[model samples]
Target: MTERQHTDQALIARIDPAALLERTRSWSAINSGTHNLHGLTHMAALLADAFAVLPGELSLVDGDAAESVGADGAITRLEHGRHLRLVVRPDAPVQMLFTGHMDTVYPVDHPFQTLAWRDANTLNGPGVADMKGGLSVLLEALRIIEAAGTPSLGYEVLINSDEETGSFSSARLIAEAACGKCAALTYEPALADGTLAGARGGTGNFSVVVRGRAAHAGRNPQDGRNAIVAASDVALRLFEARSPALAVNPARIDGGGPNNVVPDTAVLRVNFRPGDTGEIERARTLIGATTRAVAERHDVSVEVHGGFNRPPKPIDAGAARLFALVKDAGSAMSLDVAWRDTGGVCDGNNIAAAGVPVVDTMGVRGGAIHSTDEYLLVDSLAERAALSALTMSRIAEGALS
Candidate 1:
């Protein structure tokens, strides 16, 4: 191994994996799904309490007025309940931020809310792999950074109560906090095989509502426009628009009644993903044109809702540098660290879109996210925490660019 690789590996080996495992296990026991406001509050309070023990200032940033940027570039604040932010040494100008969400996709009464040990090195539970485990890693990483030595690189930790629901109510707040930061680390879990996600496709959800005249099927069928048929045609057109890099999926169709009546209203819920902005705009144009054409043909009024929620997170120079730092840190622990671009979207997309450089997959390694089988590798807790600590250390020492 090269001299730098050897030294990094030595530093990584010094981190205690056992302590990380215990902490993750304890945290995995909590249930904090998106709609579970009470659970999220409890988790936020727990995080606030945990960070309170650290030698830094902790303040809870209100995420209530977070704005949602629409497809047409219009912004509106969405009410998403409540959120929290804890800053350690917030006044430092050169700041590094760590972000994670306490809310999981599961609801409060989900059957998978409990955690159990699959083996000596694996723990299974709701949200364990999706993010609660990552939260533990963040806390431990902070502890290690403090133990290593205090450097003047300022840092803040933002733990939101709503992320599993697409950050509808916290995006603006996240953007505000992330602005002006030199770099960011988000605790989204790495792939089960330990691969990081380097780039992510742009994501958006859309709904087309069609209004038509309803009539009795037997008496005045010709008088009705049959909005359901128009919506079906639209759905098929959307599905046929898929290409190698872009896909359109008609997720759901609503508003159908008795068979004896011509349906007057229909709703089509669709989702699309494009590799970049150009493709996103192209897809949007196509969708808009198609919807208009279909509505005109059926003589029905059409309304569209939901648009690009987050922009694509492309690989920028800042992200590349962060990856190199993380790779070097992983090598110190005898691990091979690499990442690939994915079509999946996350809060990382929002932060990157806000022009902040981010290293997103700084959480535990695991698989089966958003499923009952969600599990996190116990070893990655310490491994990732150590990597984060070292990265923060290097940033403080000015060894990282």
Candidate 2:
């Protein structure tokens, strides 16, 4: 194959499992929830500090938070920003990007938010399995490659602050970094059974606001149009759009009177996931039609805000090739690895949808993600990291044909 691939395969032979696990535990102790600005900042700084020790020049990519006003004054956006970059080789042709998120779903006050030892071989923590553990694995993987003292391809690592809530502003940055890159690896945790994700559905979050006149409930019932009822109808329409492969969940409904007058306004928070672009278009059309029909029939004005925040990413031809490369690397290490399609979407979907070939769920294998039982297998830290390091090195060496 190529010299880069050969170099990567040779390095995978000497990856140290113990060092990998130690680092995973180290990072898992820090809680970096996407909604917790302070925690996110601390996590970012920690990552930056750690990367500073690497051989390549490190650069920070700046991002700003969107703000809103609250009763207490102006409420700053929850997440501060993210860190991204390229760890370059003196000379290289292919560029590979490794990606992971520093943010988790758990909030600062969450009871499920700290690191604990499930056993000598397992780590229990909020962000441990979902991704902080994965980040650790990525770093260890890179360390293994760097220690080999052979460079195959220049690489970049993109860590973002806002991934649990759909990546918002960071989506564009991911897309931009992916341009001309050969492949991408996202360190989202693996399935409970160690299966990597081959394909994932795209996610879209939306809001529907129903506006109706408010009047005395008992004295002037006819004068008031119930926005709540209009919103309910809209919710029902949304659920009716669900199919076997597609899902629609109306997460929350807000607004209404205290049983005294008609509700002037009501809002519906809805989210959906579609496996393909066609499903996304169909869902958007259905939502629009249903919203308009409900508004007209109920005599209420409706405003629909938000659109497909994250496009659904399918395992296209490019991704399939990328997955094979990872699998090959794993096999060489005597690890039997396989991939399956998943319904849950992550930042990988955002990158893949932008036309970059991605091997997501390329993180430590673990179980119970997003729950109190969340834990990561200590052994997976080294195994997966070695797998990643090998893949990158092989790609550089032109080993995979």
Best by lDDT: 1
Overlapping backbone residue pairs in candidate 1 total: 2
Q: Which model scores highest in TM-score?
A: 2
RMSD of 2: 3.1
Report, for every candidate in turn, its global Cα lDDT versus the true structure: 0.79, 0.78
Tens-digit per-residue lDDT, 295-318, candidate 1: 998898888877788788999988
> Residue 30 of model 1: what lDDT?
75
Q: Per-residue CA lDDT of candidate 2, range 3-108, in tens?
A: 7456656776677777666666677676777777777778888888877656676766766554432222223454455655546663467777888888887878
Candidate 1 residues lying further than 4 Å off, grouped into runs, are 1-19, 64-79
lDDT of 1: 0.79
Show pairs that collide, candidate 2.
2-397, 2-398, 3-397, 4-396, 4-397, 5-394, 5-397, 202-312
